[model samples]
Target: MDNVSSVIEFTLSGFDEILDYKLTFFCLTLLCYCVIIMVNVVVVVTIAMDRNLYEPMYIFICNLCINGLFGTAGFYPKFLLDLLSHHWGISYTGCLLQGLVIYTSVCSDICFLAVMAYDRLMAICRPLEHSSVMTRQRVAQLVCFSWLAPLGLLSASTIFTSRLKLCGSNIKKLYCANWMVAKLSCAATNWVTSTTPGNVIAYVIILFYIFLGVFIFCSYVQLTRCCFKSLANRGKFMKTCVPHLLALFNISIASLFDAMYMRYGSSDFPQSFQNLLALEIIIGPPLFNPLIYGLTLSQIRNQVLHKYLQNK
Candidate 1:
């Protein structure tokens, strides 16, 4: 039967597959996403209209809002629908598109964070060159590459992964992960394994290792320099750098753990743990980006309040 038969579509076990916690999980996730979206939207609005927030940092914040918005959009709709219906069904093309957008948003998120880190590094460590180094043209170029590089990577991923012949059961995690899709392949092991490098999981690790190494070294050096300054100047420097450090902490922990989990633990770990890890992909950055940036920037807080009053 194994050799003779073939497969078509995949099925997913909805979060409510066990029962009882359906409504609770639904309400909690919905509330969490609502907060994430609202806060990011406020940041975006403040950056757009507030004259005071027209700086490199806030511009990066705006870009982060857009990425988080689209990224959540890609996952939350299906997640919500699954909660409502207690069934998880996505079309083949739908799965592909979801994977594509989710990966793109993720890659874009990485690029933006790296850009933000470099921006902070220049401002803190190379203050004289801050303006000249991160000029409008340079910032525009960086942002463009952030958006474009993901497309290139994802295109390579989608093409190689799609060519493999999926056999029968398509039921993956609540979402369509590329590796899980590859698991359904009837093709030879080599063909399936060949697809790993093109997958999102692999590239995420490669990019993060490089980025994280550089980020940690740069941040530590900057923090060390700040420690030696006078209390007043040091406090000012710390104020600017603290949020970035916090953001780096959040990104580093969530990304490193999840990447490691997906790579090494997918098979060994329990299904529940794997699912939780996948949720981190959606929830971690959304929760941190606005909170960290808002806490750090006075201008952002003022603009947010100003906008709230004007809308009222």
Candidate 2:
């Protein structure tokens, strides 16, 4: 410990390649961030204002949009600043906070989507009990749990990262990642041990993915059976289920790329490709969800468009 220096700030090296075109990247990133905010806000506001939209599904969709905004907040501003500035460094404390927001928000995405899958399964496969089971108070509880659980767990993980005596100052990531920071720890070899919170989170999340996957699959199989039983159910599935599937597919693919790159990525990979993987999960869902959900869900689509035209 006497011979080693702890890292005080982390230099975000991920932006170096793209920083050559800083002016252009800054503008484009700003524009993208603005669009993400506008679309997600519209969806959330539309759902909130319309009394007709006060249903379990709409409420959950509103949360999804809100979460998208929340997650991106941790990335876009810092990213934009880095894009325009000569310095791209974040303090040690700041990095931990950013990592907390980014990681929990992404995991929260999975949680909300799982909640949505449950909502659809109930509506389709168990229509009679759906109303009773998915009461307003109940949905509120589910929402609270979905958000709080990840926040709580990751906060613990962040504490572990903070206690680490990091020997390195450079994080090749655009944003601080739990694993990346852990790798910089003076005790890097055991940072991922079973005793470590980071390792526990990794195991828990993998199990969470498998459980949600099976649950969604079974829910869909039942949904398919019901859809075949009646034309009305089939039509409903086509409208509602398709977009949910699209969102799930989009998030799943994006998360996979991010996880693979985070754990296995190295400088040997082209910086451009590394950049793509880092930004893909962060960019794809927040942008993809509102558009897909807004276009596919008729009431939301109509309400959003009506408000847009009225303002124009």
| C-alpha RMSD by candidate, in order | 3.8, 2.1
Measured with C-alpha atoms, the lDDT of residue 276 in candidate 2 is 85
Checking candidate 2 for backbone clashes, the offending pairs are: none
Lowest lDDT block of 10, candidate 1 = 1-10
Candidate 2: minimum summed lDDT over ten consecutive residues — where? 189-198
Best candidate according to lDDT: 2
Off-target runs (Cα >4 Å) in candidate 1 are 1-8, 14-18, 191-216, 219-223, 226-233, 263-270, 309-312
Residue-wise lDDT of candidate 1 within 196-229, one digit each (tens)? 5455545674775586558756766865675577
- Judge candidate 2 at residue 280 and give its lDDT: 89
Poorly placed runs, candidate 2 (over 4 Å): 1-5, 192-197
* TM-score leader: 2
**218-281, model 2: which lDDT tens digit per residue?**
8888889899999988998999999989999999999899987876676489877888899987
